[model samples]
Target: MPESELGGPEEKSYTAPGKVPLDSGWVDVPRLSLSASAGPGAFGGEERPFDNFRFSQRWLREQGLDGSHLSAITVEGDSMEPLLRAGDEVLVDHSPQPFRDGIHVVRLEDTLLVKRVAAQGGGRYSLLSQNLAYPPLEVNAQDIEIVGRVVWKSGRL
Candidate 1:
């Protein structure tokens, strides 16, 4: 048999054909095709996964996260600059829970926005932006839908 088809001294066949080697200690999280706008954009649409991101399971566990609770979405617009720039990809946690103070993906009216959220008590939240040109918006707790809490953000430096 040829070296390309047969096992070689440099290569070990540890996994079946057309399968990823799970022994490598890496897991994949789905990257949704939907984009979450950092400024004003579309609210809701079809959420189809277009790609996958590989991450170490151990590292995710260390961060108190799991693949089930995580989903990746691309960020659009510069309303949340300085912290979350335009075109950044953010990981969001979809665990069912009450909203807390942190960066989050929220839905106000028919628009979806990525903003820093602060609990203002009395069932209200203040949506803020890192850009000073954009003013903070106060919204009633019931008026907004908390899509997910932003856990991590990544983009080109």
Candidate 2:
């Protein structure tokens, strides 16, 4: 057998078997310790990165996500059910752009929440839930801080 065909000294494995190599065109985004509530829950006063999730760089670019501004947070309720479920991990973009009417993660009174926000045309937003059991929450735009926009979500089937 030739040297190239054999387990040659020049060839080295950068990662374990069945794992993606570091230079394999994948990027890691931090999974934050914060949880975005779909119901009523308060977040502890710590913003730490717990772990990282690997995603294809090409795919992220296609989705128009900036890797530097991307982070993941876990969902903690069923208010956005059928679209976002409890324990679902969602990708957030922290870019400071004009807010559009869409699903977003917001911080209100120290609680982080994920809800569909509709522009009420008077510096007010209506927070809506997919589950009809929860009523829509209306708030003045100045009260809540928009943490980020939910760009993607993943959950176990």
Candidate 3:
């Protein structure tokens, strides 16, 4: 990854894959995408917000996700910072694909950590913190349970 793709605390040296480094001076996060974005009201149609109840219960269930397949968990901490602030609502894709290097809510050991996935190191994985104050934490695969991938973060604009 390019130097710009990597970021973290000034005191930590986290050499993880797909890591977006956070520094005291690097506070500006832009709209980054691997592909071009669809502009508002111009991508054939406007994007619609997910109706939590129907989207999570009936629709998603009808789409093949059983009752045990999903749940709405209110985010409770600032460990995720700007990307996933406390009180924000995030839809957890319970029936998620195999753990990959991306964002996900993970229950490692006894702690539930909502951090950006960094790498899958055979028996362990690296979790990146959006806030520089919190250094990256390494958790063992066996000790961690993959909750789900964070589909989208919704909150006040």
Write down the lDDT of every candidate, Cα atoms only: 0.81, 0.85, 0.53
Residue 135 lDDT, candidate 3, scale 0-100: 74
Q: Write the per-residue lDDT of candidate 2 for residues 38-127, one digit (tens) a residue.
A: 977558356788888889989999998878899999999899997899999999999889889899999988899999989998899999
Q: What would you estimate as the lDDT of candidate 1? A: 0.81
Which residue pairs in candidate 1 have backbone atoms (N, alpha carbon, C) closer than 3 angstroms, thus clashing? none
Candidate 3 or 1, higher lDDT: 1
**Residue-wise lDDT of candidate 1 within 12-103, one digit each (tens)?**
44455434455567777788877777776656566788887888889898988887788898888888888888888999888888667999
Ranking by TM-score: 2, 1, 3
Q: Please give the lDDT score at residue 130 for candidate 3.
A: 74
Query: Number of clashing residue pairs in every model?
Result: 0, 0, 6
lDDT of 2 at 133: 88
Model 2 lDDT, residue 111, Cα: 90
Model 3 ranges with Cα > 4 A deviation: 1-52, 56-68
Which ten-residue region of model 2 has the weakest summed lDDT?
Answer: 1-10
Pairs with steric clashes in candidate 3: 6-21, 7-20, 7-21, 7-22, 8-21, 8-22
Query: Which number leads on TM-score?
Result: 2
**RMSD for each model, in Å, please?**
4.7, 5.0, 20.5
Q: Pick the candidate with the highest lDDT.
A: 2
Q: What would the per-residue lDDT of candidate 3 be over residues 21-134, giving only the tens digit for each residue?
A: 343222111221111101110111222323333232444445554434544444555666777666666655677466677777676554555678777667878878777777
